[model samples]
Target: MAPLSHYLVLSGILFTIGVMGVLVRRNAIVVFMSIEIMLNAVNISLIAFDRYLGQHDGQIFSFMVMAVAAAEVSVGLAIVIAMFRNKPTINLDEFNLMKW
Candidate 1:
C-alpha cells in the first residue's frame, strides 16, 4: 500500500491544479469543475489522514463535504442555466456582482 505521505502529496497536487484552473479559466462551467476538483482533493486528503490517525472524524467530515458538494451542484447548475438564458453567455465578465 502507498504511504500516507504519498496520498497527502497527491492531494496537494490535485488541489493546486484545481486552484490554478479556477484562477485561469473564464467559463463558469470550467470554474465549477475546478471547484469540484478542489473538493475531491480535500476529500482524498481527509480520508488519508483519517486512516493514518485511526480516527473517523476526517471520514465524517469528508462525507459532509460530499453532501454539501452535491447540493451545490444542484443549485449551481440551476443558477448557471438561468444566467445562460439571460446573458446568452457563460463568461464570468458578464455577471453583475454589485447590482441590486
Candidate 2:
C-alpha cells in the first residue's frame, strides 16, 4: 500500500495544475474544467485522509463536494450558454456582464 504522503503529494500536484489552468486559461469551459479538477483534487485528499484515520467523515464530505460541483456545473454551463448566445464567444476576457 502506498503511504499517505504519496497521496497527499499527488493531490497537491493536481491542485497546483488546476490552479494554473484557472489562472492562465482564457476560455470559460476550460476554467470550469479546471475548477472541477481542483474539486477532485480536494476529494482525493479527503479520501486519503479518511483512509489514514479509519473514519468515514472524509468520504461523506467528499460526497457533499461532488454534489456542490454538480450544481455548479449545471448553473455555470447555463450562464455560459446564455452569454455565448448573446456575444458568440466564451472568452473570459470578453465578458463584461457585470460592468455598467
Candidate 3:
C-alpha cells in the first residue's frame, strides 16, 4: 500500500496545479475547470486521511463537498451562459456585467 505521505504529496501537487490554473488562465471556462480541480484535490486529501485514520467522517465530508461542487457547477454554468449571451466572449477580462 502507498504511504499516507505519498498520497498527501500528490494531493498537494494537484491543489497547487489547480491554484496555478486559476491564477494564470484568462478564459472563464478554464478558470471554472481549475476551480473544479481544486475541489477534487481537497476530496483526494480527505479520502487519503480517512483511509489513513480508518474513519468515515472524512469520506462523508468529501461526499458533501462533491454535492456542493455539483451545485456550484450547475449555477456557475448557467451564469456563464447568460454572460455569454450578453457578451460574445468567455474571457474573464471581458466579463464586466457588474462593473460600474
List model 3 lDDT by residue over 1-100, tens digit each.
8999998999999999999999999999999999999999999999999999999999999999999999999999999999888887988887565977
Any runs in candidate 1 off by more than 4 Å, and if so which? 96-100
Best by TM-score: 2
Question: What is the C-alpha lDDT profile of model 2 across 1-100, one tens digit per residue?
Answer: 7999999999999999999999999999999999999999999999999999999999999999999999999999999998888899988998775976
| Comparison by lDDT, 2 against 3, better one | 2
Task: Please list the residue runs of candidate 2 whose C-alpha ends up more than 4 Å from where it truly belongs after superposition.
Answer: 97-100
- Pairs in steric clash, model 2: none
lDDT of 2: 0.96
